[model samples]
Target chain A: MASSNTEPVIIVEGLTARYGEVTILQDVSFEVYRGERFMILGGSGCGKSTLLKHMIGLIKPHAGRVVIDGVDITRADEETLHRVRSRIGVLFQADALFGSMSLAENVSLPLAEYTDLPPELIREIVRMKLGLVNLAGYDNHMPSELSGGMRKRAGLARAMALDPTFLFYDEPWAGLDPVTAAELDILIRSLNEGIGTTMVFVTQELASIFSLGQRVIMLHKDVKGIIARGTPQELRETSSDPRVNHFFNRQAD
Target chain B: MPEMNHRGYRLHVEGAPGAQAAVRLEGRLALEDLKALMADLQAVPVKMKPREIAVDVAGVEYLDSAGAMALIEMENLSRSLGIPFELLGVSEKDHGLLCLIDREALQRPPLRPESERPAIVVRLGEVARRQYRDVLEIMTFVGELVAALAYCLVHPRSIRWEEVKFYMKRAGADGLPIVALISLLLGLIMAFMSSLQLKQFGANLYVANLVTIAMVRELGPIMTAILVAGRSGSAFAAEIGTMVVNDEVNALVTMGFDPIRFLAVPKVLAAMVVVPILTVYADFFAILGGLIVGITGLDLTAFTYIQQTKSSIRVFDFATSLVKAVVFAMLISGIGCQRGFQVRGGAEGVGMSTTSAVVSAIFLIIVADSAFAIMLHYVRH
Candidate 1:
């Protein structure tokens, strides 16, 4: 691992997703540099989630490829998809944990799903994850028992359970308290420093995006293709996309 | 899927010399005239064996049993008159009508016999071959479910015995009291109903025999099973179905654990283990219910009732009932788990799959129980 700034780790070329007669994304192209906490910032219904979905291989693009770490995940088979997906941890919008299981169980799910580790080792990994989220003692609590912040933390723990190379957080600050949000941002920062993990945060939550993202790719829905991609300060001062400022509109510390 | 209309008809009249015909029909035929011709045949003034009586029905759109019965009567009349009768509109729908009157009407003439038959099975086979994976998937799920249980025996720790225990308590023990109560009341009701009728014939003592025979041979095991199936079986479906919809199954799959081995084996094992036990309890309560009836309604002593039950109910009969319970247990739980794991999409899909599981399981249980009863019947004889 270089552990240094380098070429983009993710590149989307001429990407589009279409229904019968409607286009969701149109010939969109972008690149995410290595070690950059690059964000795709857009308002709701602006294809932000759709773009993120394409990146994680949940939904395939209509006409382009998602090249992640040099492997094209656009048309991957199950094993390939699993491998690619495991490398990219996704925090789904609603925290898609298995409801029947407890917090520790949820965090351990990916590890349990993909590893051949003994139960004892799996328990240790789960303990380690919960501990990272400051949820060290809520291991046996069901998802329903956790508050919004706690649930998000548990979900984060699960997402980070596999020690993914890249983390994708979808609106992680949407429903959390400011204190919790700030704590989460610090945790994310600590995680980045500690593991040197690359991150792609998809959010219109301005505070979280600005505080967490090192660079940003703003989506502009003009009659043409995507309008801009740049660093936060460069985007804040000089970006021409009207949608760009709108994403940063509700920015509150 | 089916449509109906009431509309017009027309009649035409034609026949041999001196034959007079009048139509009782009142409307214009949708197209050509056939009623007038039937009237022509009915007039029959000549009282002669005409070579043939002919009617064209090609324009007829609607037909009634009256119209069809008239045709039947006219055919008999033709046999009497020694004239061959002919109907022109021999389309498929018309042929169906003719078949209703006389099945031979649908039979093909020698030249067209093979041509008219459907290519349904061969075409269906081709379609099945093309959609073979669906068949393979179903087979695989069923195979894996069975293998999962087989795996459980050798590797019990791999199966989550705790979850199975949880479901068994929910599905079996908690539900057992109600099931037992209902079976008991059912035995009392059957005995009471039969006692009213049999008392008229002064055969009150045989009521014990009736209750014993019916409960052990048919009602106790079947009713108790059906109650449990509807109660606990549907619960199994809904619970597991919810897990499936919530991506728990996918989570399991990604974890390198076979969901069937992880999920289904436990539920299947629990139900298979518990249902027969529940059936035995139901049997005990039902006998108790009949014994209560014997003392209060029939004036027969409890000892007499018990004696008659013991003397009449054989070990083989009890075995048959218990064996049926065990089999029904397997069927209900297996189908319930199968449906649960097969859930697709949201709340509506889970609900539908649960309903289907109950219906299919109940029907299969009844059918298998009937077959088992018949085999036992033959063996006993």
Candidate 2:
């Protein structure tokens, strides 16, 4: 209940997500506290990504509301949504960096568009952000020129450009070697600690869940809603739900 | 004393000229206040001309990274001017934000040079080398296409007739309306212009002669081919280019199918079969257009116009036009598929290949037409 002591930055109340006739998440509700690393875990074809999309306001839900920092993004106007979006960043599954832009240009894009800060200050911030992600000197490299791991790191740097209050990651560990994935895990942890940004991640990586997630919510396709909610350690050892217990045990094996 | 206030965020510098300066920052020092922050900070050294400056952030209610960078930038400016600068009363949280970035790293120049261009001679050499490689690539692709076509001929059942029918509908039947429209307009315009001249010589019936000959021998096949080049050629390139980008072409190869025979052969075969038929349709529509002008504008009977057109064009002329249509069809579809197979990058690459396909197809069609004119003349002689 230490998390309950803190104010909730994101409130998802009775959210229902549907694609055509199929319901992916129904009447799902959860709260993510300030400065918490929350992981959304589930089996394949579950509503993990659908829920993340609803949370980020990329896709509207069939029913319910997602309020981020006092603004209900699902119901917000364009101006309000734009304002709320400026305070957040998302890292996509494929590290969706613009192929046409250099790393420096990509990192500086948000600053240039949103702020009236001078170019030199923006450039300096770009360098510092890139430095934080261990890509200090790769400012001019194109997205196509970098390896998959480097591109992911570059994507993280761009995501951190505005020092967003909330950061969302969609399967950041996918398509990486174990070493690179572990390195990425450390980077995520450091960034969360350094900036104190609330993070929402959609992933099925058990190692990342155990290592990084402070609180976890598992979704099941059959349930069409949150199946389990607890600390990773608690979910591993003390979960009453057989499906949740089986998920933790099967992955560990 | 100089001060800047933007939305209650304020920067105040108190000092006499060429003397010690104390700068105080107050209110929310965040992103929205940064422009005023930098403007005020930049003005401090200019107006006060301080030999030493101290920035006090204790009055600041909140500070973010952009605000932190403003302070860092101020320190750099003072240092460059040989003026002593100090940051005072920064909270530990703000200090951590400030410490996250190393000033030295920001000062380091980027590894890449900005827009490096070679000497003119070297650029010319590169362009020439690229052209040579392009020609060689086209030759290799043509060789592969010939071999694939030969294989298909030996095994007629190997051709994917379903795709051929689909492409025929796409490239031929779908294109018929536009082809008919443009040919009709072409015939109407030619007959109108030529009737004015021939009427002066009391040869008004010769308008049919002129329109029928031009439509069948030259304008019919060439215009149809050019329109198809613009329509189906770009479509073929973009379709195959996107397939290459998505690695579907590679998948076909990996699954033990020749990509050219699997993808291009159907399109080429469909175009080769249908484009000539489209040319014949174009010729007929053009003649109908000429007949309209003959009966309406020139006061000539339909029977007279039809007989004059029949007398003007020989079977030899129709044969040449069909030959030209077949050759132009090959060039258009062939160039499109070749450009598609040459795609290397992503969406932009596909776009470039599509545009190149249309331009190269049209250019080759005109060149082949000119060569045909000369060869046919020598053969007739």
Candidate No. with top TM-score = 2
How high is the CA lDDT of each candidate model? 0.72, 0.89
Off by over 4 Å in 1: A1-204, A207-253, B1-138
TM-score of B-chain for each predicted structure, in order:
0.63, 0.94
State, as a TM-score between 0 and 1, how close model 1 is to the true structure.
0.43
lDDT of 2 by residue, B62-128 (tens): 7766677778888998888889999999887677667766677667777775457999999999999
The candidate 2 chain B region of ten consecutive residues with least summed lDDT is B1-10
- Interface RMSD (one decimal) of model 1: 37.4
TM-score for each model:
0.43, 0.90
- Displacement of residue A243 (Cα, Å) in model 2 is 3.4
lDDT of 1 by residue, B1-381 (tens): 111224355454544443423223334331112343334446542353456666566655544322443455566676566666666654564455344333222121222121243599988887888558645755777788777778788887887879889878877898788988897898799889999999999999888889888888888778877887898778878988999878888899999988777777777788877887888788788888888888999999989899988998999888878888888888888888777877775676788878978887888888998899789878999
lDDT of 1 by residue, A89-147 (tens): 88877787666677877877887786655665466556656666667666677777678
DockQ for all models = 0.01, 0.43
- For this target, which candidate reaches the highest lDDT against the unseen true structure? 2
